[model samples]
Target chain A: MTAAAADKPKKLVIIDYSGELEKTWATMILASTAGAMEMETTVFVTFWGLQTFVKDKKRITGENWMQKMMSFMQRPGASHRKLSKMNFMGMGPWMMFKLAKKYNVAKPKDLLEMAMAMGVQFLPCQMTMDMFGLKREDLIEGMGEPVGAATALQLMTEADSTLFI
Target chain B: MANLDIKLKVDASGLSCPLPILKATQGIKTVESGELVEVIATDPGSVKDFDAWAKATGNALVEQDSADGKFRFVLRRK
Candidate 1:
């Protein structure tokens, strides 16, 4: 590699499509760790992944009836996420939180904060927002501008490592 | 060992993977170049993590040892 390229910080791009609690945890942990490692990290959140960034308690939002129903069913926000398996009627996330605390692992919310503090970028998908009828105000604060597939692909091309979660 | 001057001491015991390294990264920055930053962690994975971090960041892992289930590392900032 060229000297300039070698000196450049490593870049990590993560394309996240799932909003399950475990998956979101994985995305945040990896992104935060990468940021800690001094890498340039960006997460492209699309489809269900965008739901995780939605503001808490704004569960019943959307422009139309169908969109509203989709929002109601999914219940936007990271705090309301369920595990992909062993959810056990809301018992899984509770148990997972307990285990994480005992092990001194940061909660997903805290991890997200760390990632933000460390300058990890979160890019929401514009197309998904339109399809889901989600407005910019519905998302959590400090989100990067809404982008599309082209932008995501361009970032992936420049990144040293790309992850799909 | 007693003569070594440590500029920063981070106790990361009971923390999980990446946290210890993150703490080390933060601690190393607080010290001047060539000064030592020591970290104590309980995570088994910290051994490899610190080694890789040192190599990747150009910091020197000057000392490392483990006792009573806690891993310790001393790094000199680049």
Candidate 2:
């Protein structure tokens, strides 16, 4: 390989907006794999995604009876029903936690820790934090300063790959 | 026989596509060059995922085995 090509770093930007099974899995995979490739990775959590990384919030594992029942009902090819239930009185996040546990998917907090251990950069959106009355300390540890959407946009623009989940 | 011995195991069982590959990638990073990382996963998609990942990342797939809904692979880091 050419010297320049060998020296160039792979950049990955993962935008996490959903606090669901899909979003968490996508973020963790990208962070861990890209980090392994010695790539520079940045995970930007915005809006509802912030809950996944908040220190005060524990990832809800679907260990409860109700959650277990919900999982049984939502099968593959049941997207519409799943989406509808997700929007029901904050059932979405609860169900997400249950599914994550049922599937053996790593918890968001664990994923964040793994990302940090792997040297992935984690950023929270400044606007969203302010709107939600969240302080920097409210977030999980190892996170850098809250950045604006413009910064995230710039990072995405410069990335080799970008995913919104 | 000693020369072909591969060490390192990552239990990626119960994980889905991209996760198995992703975990294997991370496990390989913690080892020295030329060392092998064995990934054990239950995802049906892992067979193809590992093939694609090995190609994309310049790693060599030394061995692959599947049985009872479990898939295993040994990857040599380049």
Candidate 3:
């Protein structure tokens, strides 16, 4: 290998906090697609995203009407939005999930399963666990230890690519 | 009949979005070049999702048909 190639990092770290199924799937696709190209991948789920990793959590619900309304309002035309604006209620999240079902998109649980099958590292956020009063046992099987955001950030810093979804 | 001779069917019904793509990805991996994969789905999002998947993965979608809340996708693996 060339000297420059030898110095390059082959790892990717993704910090997923969107909590929406579509966003989560998008993040997974990016990471897994990268991994398919031979990059090592690590996904750190924090805050609301951590709920999806919990064994008993069936779905990530909008906390309130305002949050739900704001989610819809923030799509495309919201003044304060910075990241890619998505329509969760309209053609975004629900649609993505529906198409996924029709096209045999991997189930949320199956995505996790495929991640494991593909050797993707799954890390749960410790602070989120504390905030939610959840224990390690509450998480699905095959998850790594609960880690702090700092540690996750460090991993991201060292990775070739880092994404916050 | 000759033009549509190659037929491949994938039952993505009851599955979710990325799962269909994921399954299609796996299914395509086993198919020879120029073979067609027909995916049956109920999700409305499958329309755009399959289009995007075909674009991203270098697969050619020969046909897409929808009726009665079900979608049929004919993809030619490149």
Clashes of each: 0, 1, 15
DockQ values per model: 0.42, 0.29, 0.15
Tell me the tens digit of each residue's lDDT in model 1 across A37-128: 77899999999999999998796878999999998787889888899999997899999999999989887887888788889999999999
Q: Tell me, per candidate, how large a share of the native contacts it keeps.
A: 0.33, 0.26, 0.29
> For each candidate, what is chain B's TM-score?
0.96, 0.89, 0.88
Residue-level lDDT tens digits of model 1 in B1-78: 567898899999999977898778778878998999999999999999988777666678899999999999998887
Please write out the lDDT profile of model 2 over residues A38-133, one tens digit for every residue: 678998888767656655442221345654453344321102122333557547756876777788766545555667887899898988776655
Candidate 1 CAPRI classification by DockQ: acceptable
lDDT of 1: 0.88
Which ten residues in a row are the worst by lDDT in model 3 chain A? A75-84
Q: Write the per-residue lDDT of candidate 2 for residues B3-53, one digit (tens) a residue.
A: 466678999998854567667877888889898888899988889877766
**Distance from true location, Cα of A69 in model 2, Å:** 30
Give candidate 1's total backbone clashes.
Answer: 0
Worst 10 residues of 1 chain A by lDDT: A1-10
Q: Which stretches of candidate 2 lie over 4 Å from their true place?
A: A1-7, A18-26, A36-38, A57-84, A87-99, B1-3, B17-19
